[model samples]
Target chain A: MPQGQPAVVPTDGLTTRQRRNRPLLVLHTGEMKGKSTAAFGLALRGWNQGWSIGVFQFVKSAKWKVGEENAFRALGRLHEQTGEGGPVEWHKMGEGWSWSRKQGTEEDHAAAAREGWQEIARRLSAEQHGLYVLDEFTYPLHWGWIDVDEVVTALRERPGHQHVVITGRYAPQALVDAADLVVEMTKVKHPMDAGQKGQKGIEW
Target chain B: MPQGQPAVVPTDGLTTRQRRNRPLLVLHTGEMKGKSTAAFGLALRGWNQGWSIGVFQFVKSAKWKVGEENAFRALGRLHEQTGEGGPVEWHKMGEGWSWSRKQGTEEDHAAAAREGWQEIARRLSAEQHGLYVLDEFTYPLHWGWIDVDEVVTALRERPGHQHVVITGRYAPQALVDAADLVVEMTKVKHPMDAGQKGQKGIEW
Candidate 1:
């Protein structure tokens, strides 16, 4: 069946265009790969449509450079030069969040996580971007560094037509319940399961 | 945890580089959205790595222009002019296959699907592309139009390090079993549940 077509339609009297224009809260979570990749893909689509795109990476190390970062950055530059496409901004935790700033203690990390969420909340309230990607965000919630209830509340109460997509494994149930869309990447098999390691082009 | 840390380490004697260089057969399947989006993201990664990318669409109509198609095609042209990245080729069933040549029937679609697979097989044998995306490929197999066993056998025995990613729902058991990586997208909730329709760029 087509996606999101639940048997019962709860949206009564809304025109198709009205329903189409509503903002979406999307979650990509589970043990398998591609959650972040899929979010990047959606960001690309949003960028194509002239939607401001903001990517906030929560867990990755500072040195790691995924291919999407390069592609989107280039696209961002192209947008700036040509006045075509949407603006793109990418922020990694190692650079943007204090949690990765020092050889910190657990409490420090928790404080940093809280600060990160606060920053996101500020942006959400300001209506900073059309598409906001909270990449690998579940880790903070999973580790109890960031409260799931607060994240859910911020997302639920955020203003504007901004769309939020959070990607990571072990998503909190409260966030899932609040999300308009959630996809769990279930692993049936993996190359690492067969003793293969991540390669430069494919993995990064 | 990081993906694919196989417990048994089946590739005992292979060097890390050697194991990393092995071709992969990846499947993105399930009831949720993002299967195609994730595949396109991989294709984007492949393009960034200077790898030739080939996309074969089996189900979507020719007139339906997805944002990724436009992005990749533009990237492909940029590569041709600058020689900075890899080449990209996109062929849809409604355009590139036999169905486009004549007034068609279900049998014609089956024929086109078969011909499409044959072309991909030829490319696999020739190692023409570093990454091959068979978009919406499951429908033919699910409909009994294409033989799943043959596909599995070909992929298992294929030459070179060309990666293949097939995206669609209802993937065959044999294909899933033979795949190096398989991810099933489980839907928890969707915007359509609230009677929201697909928006341009977001859905196409």
Candidate 2:
């Protein structure tokens, strides 16, 4: 509530319940940290709401284990054992989209990215999850590995109440136009600016 | 890695281990969302690292049960019973810093905010927690309820390895200059721009 609401108002005459129920397409893109982290936080919220959560990691290496993944995976296990929260499915495109650990070539990486998008599309069509977090997804789109038009089309046409969040720097304008919410993180200062290196628990 | 590192290098020639061990002062502020949410995500990371986590909510009403609080509280319980994660202590200034549900006068709220900051300073001095999340703390300094100079001095002169993250809009210039890291959340687009109201699991 600190930031005043925009002057624009919804033209669609829907009830509050209807508006609240509508799925959201959120994009977190900017030149600062915490975009993916914010998305993960959103997933945590959805999990607490008993909504199925799906996380797809694109740029981060599979070997680099982030803490949110550990916490969410643990929560997922808790859900299975006690049914306290929603189920979670985590997949890493950095792992080559399959069990094999080999990183073949640029073409291979592109193909893997496309394959990952295809799988997301399948899940969206099937309504497999209520909250979909495409962590570091902007890179593929920015690099031209994935077609932005196709992604926009698929997201616009997706069925069911599925909320999607894509996070990364240099998010394309097409995606921005299609998204219901977009946040651009601007860096005011950083420790690294002061010549401090990234620490284990703070950065990753 | 997305935002380029600052050109300034540390003048102190500390070893990698020594530099990594130093505590950080992080500030998240701007006219956008996710400042507090991102701080919560950082707390989640600290919990995964088996570090003590302290969260002090300054602005949000105590009666509002946000999802991150629920998840962190659950994680805290897990830590106590099985020692799976770290211990978490959450306090809210909105509830007058007490367990009793009472909305006191404005003076009472101001008093509670100061008390909360004093407790944080004590904890920092005592090295009580590895990570301390001062959620929505910027407002106190901006509103002149707490002294920014005192805060900066306390943080700069504090003992032990205590990392603090302060989040809110309208953060004071003095506080921003004092922080080791500062992120300004800029709004490109927001759902509220479309006249959609904040909903459960998403807003809280």
Candidate 3:
């Protein structure tokens, strides 16, 4: 909204309303904070629009209770009880890799990451949710645990009006190329510069 | 959390815990989106930690029903009823500038902005909230409606551990210099480039 008008508009065949309604592939990638936090914020906006929200975490441990996770889980319950906003589903690949029981090995982690991506691909094919948040999902693609081309193809070809947002550092060029919106969070300064350590609530 | 260690550790003679618990002044400024949204997400995290959250919007119209406002209002009521999260207070300066009865003039708007900043300064002196979000507060400073030196002085000398976050474009150099953490939201790509206009839920 800050950018009242785009610098350039392409000569696409679609009308203005059609283009406005098009689902977005938003990517937040940089070597700074607020990438995933901003994605969760976008998910909040989507949820307020009565859209089903799905969040998939790739790096954080399942045992770790993040503040966003707690808040979103509570929101999910609120939706179930009052039907005020929309449905929310949150899944993490850390220790709670429900698809497989294997863990503690690099190969197993890669396999789990692949499985996670596969599940997302399936859900995309089915148009399962209105907004899908692949939190820190670029790590797998960057690490080659999941194929970047495959992910890009799946995203570019996904059907329905489902929106997808991916957040992490070191996003692959192909994925960035395919994304409709890309933001790089650049750190001008950090509290750590003053010898402060990460504390409770703020870091998580 | 991403930066595991600070690049340089200051020798301020403060203990690790003391430095860790020190309040922070964060500024988000850039031409891209997500500045205020990310601040709201941080507010959610702070709320989970039982920190009183206060949000003051300087730019957006009070009549506009933003999604984060609704969600946070619900969270605030939830805290009141069940004591789940901390308390939340959201205020906007659009048409709801209650400090003055004047409207429709640049001078009146400037006076209202000054009044709003004075109120925030009073709250800071009182140490009212654990986290204070001055959404789009930089605009007044940029417009010369509020003094940057006055704000920086209040924020730096404020008592207690009240974290302050300011969001907007064109942040003053003085303010950025005073802030402990500063992030610039840079846009690599935007949907508007493809002729898409801002849509409901995503933009608001």
Candidate maximizing TM-score: 3
Docking verdict class for candidate 2:
medium
Ranking by lDDT: 3, 2, 1
Docking class of 3: medium
For model 2, residues B84-125, the per-residue Cα lDDT tens digits are 878999888775774434554554667778888898888888
Model 3 regions lying over 4 Å from their true place: A96-107, B98-107
**lDDT tens string, model 1, B94-182?**
54463344444443677778888998898899989999999999899999989999888888888988999999988999998999899
User: When superposed on Cα atoms, how far off is each prediction in RMSD?
Assistant: 3.1, 2.4, 2.1
Candidate 2 TM-score versus the reference:
0.94
Clashing residue pairs, candidate 2?
Answer: none
On TM-score, the stronger of 2 and 3 is 3
Per-residue error (Å), model 1, residue B89: 1.5
Ranking by TM-score: 3, 2, 1
**Tens digit of lDDT per residue, candidate 1, span A80-121?**
877667898887774447333654333355666677788889
> Between the candidate structures 1 and 3, which one is better when assessed by TM-score?
3
What are the DockQ scores of the candidates, in order? Answer: 0.62, 0.66, 0.73
In model 1 chain B, the worst 10-residue window by lDDT is B98-107
lDDT of 3 by residue, B92-150 (tens): 88764645535665545677788888989999999999999999999999999899999
Chain A of candidate 3 scores what in TM-score? 0.94
